[model samples]
Target: MILLDDVHKTFGSVHAVRGVTFEVPPGQIVGLLGPNGAGKTTTIRMSVGYFMPDRGRVVIDGHDTRESPEAARSRIGYMPEATPLYPEMRVADYLDFRGRLFAMDRSSRREATARVMDRCDLTQVAHRRIGVLSKGFRQRVGLAAALLHDPPVLVLDEPTNGLDPAQIREVRGLVKELAAKRTMLISSHILSEVERLCDRLIVVSGGRVRGDGTPERLAAAASQEREYVLEARFDTDESARGFEAAVASLSGVASCSSSEPLDGAWRRFRVSARADGADLRESLAAAARARDIPVRELHALTPSLERAFHALADAGEEANP
Candidate 1:
């Protein structure tokens, strides 16, 4: 539903984005992740037509943002990090003003305002002034305004920022519910939130696209090798050392280390191996049985998205520096 191809932007001598390219498929929720000063907001602005890319294209639903900015922007609903709101206006009034800006008729404005208020759970607070409402309620007002026009695409930057646990949960749930019908591009610092909500991720650093894929795919791409956890019991420390030696002797095994002391005679070990398309569990079990070692448990450990994000960011920094 959205595409950025070789987009580049600069301010004075500082290049904010450099040949960054990615796509958000229809009915998909994609997360735009990056460290501070990595041009995430700049890229988002260009996508929404708030700022024009110095080079390349930003397209939304087949309309080029540079060539048909109004039409392209009309398809998108943008809720910025610091939601701009009229402090003195009531929630309903604020939504009405937003509808008016979209040139919605009086009847259409009322209908859209009512629908978004209900969707965002702001009905009870509709009569309250935005400044008097809680931060969470104010955020809902901003979101309601963004949805007033019923855009097919949503661009949300830090949608849950500055909210309490309860409020954050509320907002997250609403975003998820909205994603059922609309394409969403979310940029958040909360990695776990992104991991939970996003179908795919676009990792950016130093104004460049560093990685793009599903979370698991990105993690696997960043990981140098596979890891496995092994637990077993031995009669003596010498036997434990022997078991480690046997496991390390396996062809694909790169290194092995004791992770934790289990019970009186049981111990846990973390085994790292080369990405040789080999299943070490079978070999590990066979080796344990040969040495008369009782295997308690064995399983592979999947690399985390957080680790993958940092790895990509670090790689970008090193390449640019």
Candidate 2:
């Protein structure tokens, strides 16, 4: 529902975004992830018409943000990292004000405000002043205002930034609930949360898209080869040497390196192999059996999204350096 096509932005000599591009499909939650100064917020601002891109287009639905900003923005509900709110206003009052800004009629405003208050679980606190509410409640108020118009898309920047554990979980649940009805583009620094919440990820660094895919796909792209950890015990040092040689000779086995010894007779090793969808464990076990080596542990080591994110970010830095 949202598309950023080769978007570029600059402030003085600093290029905040450089040909960054991605799309958020309908009813999908996409995470915009990156380190500091990676242009995530800038991209989000462009998407919501808060800032115009210097080059390329930010399109929402079928409207171009640069050519029809108002129409494009009308379809989006935006919750910025630092929420702008009237401290003295009650939560319900603030939502009413937001509705009026969208030109919602008095009847429509009341209905929208009531729906969002309940949707965001802010019904009990609707009568409380925003100034006296906890950070989490204030955040809920901001979200309710964003949803007052019932837009088809939501752009959320750091939706769980400063909340306590309980508050964070609450917010996460709310986001997930909202996603069932709207396309969402969420930008977060919390890798684990993104891993759990996002269906796809766009990893940016140095104002460029370094990686884009599902978490599993990105991990696979970052890993050049499949790896396994093998631990085995041998009756003699000579037997261990023979076992290593046999494993190294197996088909698809790229390389084998000895790790720290498990004890005097048992040793741990890392086996690297081409990721060709082949089962190398059976081969390794058979080699050990032929060599009379007793197996202690053998398992494939799965790649992690955290590692893939850092690897792509590091690659981006090196390319631009």
Q: Write the per-residue lDDT of candidate 2 for residues 147-190, one digit (tens) a residue.
A: 89999999998888778898888888888888997889999999
Each prediction's number of clashing residue pairs: 0, 0
TM-scores, all models, native as reference: 0.94, 0.89
- Candidate 2 lDDT: 0.88
Give candidate 1 regions above 4 Å deviation. none
Q: What is the lDDT of candidate 1?
A: 0.89
> Which residue pairs in model 2 clash with each other?
none
- Cα misplacement distance, residue 173 of candidate 1 (Å): 3.4
Best by TM-score: 1
